[model samples]
Target: MGEFKVLEIKQSIFEDNDKDAEAVRAELKEKGVFLLNLMSSPGSGKTTTLCRTIELLKNQLRIGIMEADIDSDVDAKTIAEQGVKSIQLHTGGMCHLDADMTRQGLKGLGIEDVDLAILENVGNLVCPAEFDTGSVKNAMILSVPEGHDKPLKYPLMFSICDVVLINKIDVMPYFDFDLEKCKEYIAMRNPNAKVIPICARTGEGMEEWAAWLKEEVNEWQTN
Candidate 1:
């Protein structure tokens, strides 16, 4: 009976998480807020990509961000300077941010007031893949310096991602990162995933990303 009680407790927690995630998504939909959960490994330039995206879309859309980090305030401060409303989430050394933590962060984000809310997950490739933060879309950025094997090595993130942003394309000549191979791997894992090559620093692929986002938002608006 004791073991059965613990199992019941665990089951209840899992069920509760799923229910909460659904509720959060429904609420965001009603508010017309398109939430995107961005995930990537450390140094993959997730924050830089976000800042660039926000800058590009700010004039057209009310952009907001929920920045998740283990300790450093660098990313949050830098994002806030760009004139977008961003809430910093300090995970206190947790490798991944669960739906509950994200719920707390979203409660503080005032998401209903914005058109789009981007959740930048703690810079982690693997663990973040195992969790859902009640986002409308899951975006993953893979930098050229990270090598092409990332999709194969960290399959879950790629598999679950709605879109794959290939960052640091300018560094393609310097690094051995093959964009074609990366696309192939991503396709193998997620055959339907849209892959966009981008140089976040130079804003090369910002337009394409923005266009994709606009399409998604338009569809949401109509449906």
Candidate 2:
């Protein structure tokens, strides 16, 4: 107790991260690359959904993907097999990717010719929501098996997302997930959130998702 020093470390860290995020956003805007930060819990079908999405839009857009994980390059391998530009990002022991990490991943992926670059963030709802990745839009997927009560437990994730994809809708009959109730919960927390129910495996409900993405990318490019 010789000398007591109080440091507001958390606030300072967040402020610095925000500045980096803003710079990343400006750089992406100038290059006309629409980066999407996709967040979700593990087993949410994010990879399958992305494969379907690439199939739908690859002909029209030059797409690249950054598959982020705490370990392993499995998802990146899966995406590369689809013949799109893909890069694997290892976060070491970190749970989330901050703006600087995202910028590094983008550089590795080489976004110069990429029209739409998607960062498939590490599988989690909490840490990913806490950091800004500087994407043009934020999106998350909540599969039917995960239930309709997730928003009640993880409000911040839902609150920050521009769109929420309700994946594994094909298994809705087997699960007790209430689609309308889930939508209600998400809407209560995020009134402007767009919830799209999709079955990525069978390609159901993907058209609507693709259309929304097309519109979003077009808007981002023009304005």
Candidate 3:
């Protein structure tokens, strides 16, 4: 028989990442920094939503943004124009940000002075959900054009997120997207998850989204 070396590679990788994630989370907590790992598909309006969020809370929090992409500083530039601290993280062709990578981004962004650090993770569903980035909370956005069946196709992403934003709701009339069905799908996968519908372009439903964020940040800081 040929020699067989069983590595259990996937299991080992996850275990190692989990340890690093815990350490990163502890360090951030001790520094009073609330990190949010935001994930979504490309063109889901994550940057626009983030811009709206920054506008709403910039006065209340020392906000910082880490825009992770395979290669692009556009989002970082957009965030910087909002007058908040921003950094662009090139993932070197990788599709996700693991704990160590996230820690490095935080260092670049000077997270110690940031009360709220939002990591706009690589624009993908599969890879980002599989790895923990040591964020205080994980959020994903599902635009109405993406359809409600996403939760069924990407259950792990839906299951792991603390909150899910249903973006581009203003176009809900044009698309075949069913809002209730989407909510049902998310609830089935993650009952504890908070789902907020918003049209990031027009600022519709932003107040609710901002309120939830404010509450979460407050809780993260005090606890």
For each candidate, the alpha-carbon lDDT, in order, equals 0.87, 0.96, 0.95
lDDT of 1 by residue, 142-197 (tens): 99998999999988889999999999999899998888989999999999999999
lDDT of 3 at 138: 97
lDDT of 1 at 135: 84
Task: Count the clashes in each prediction.
Answer: 0, 0, 0
Candidate RMSDs in Å, in order, are 2.4, 2.0, 2.4
Ordered by lDDT, highest first, the candidates read 2, 3, 1
Off by over 4 Å in 2: 1-12
Q: lDDT tens string, model 2, 1-223?
A: 5898898656666888899999999999999999999999999999999999999999988999999999999999999998999999999989999999999999999999999999999999999999999998999999999999999999999999999999999999999999999999999999999999999999999999999998999999999
Candidate 3 lDDT (Cα, whole model)?
Answer: 0.95
Candidate 3 off by > 4 Å? 1-11
Of the candidates shown, which would achieve the greatest lDDT relative to the real structure? 2
Q: List the residue pairs that clash in candidate 3.
A: none
Question: Model 1 off-target regions past 4 Å?
Answer: 1-14
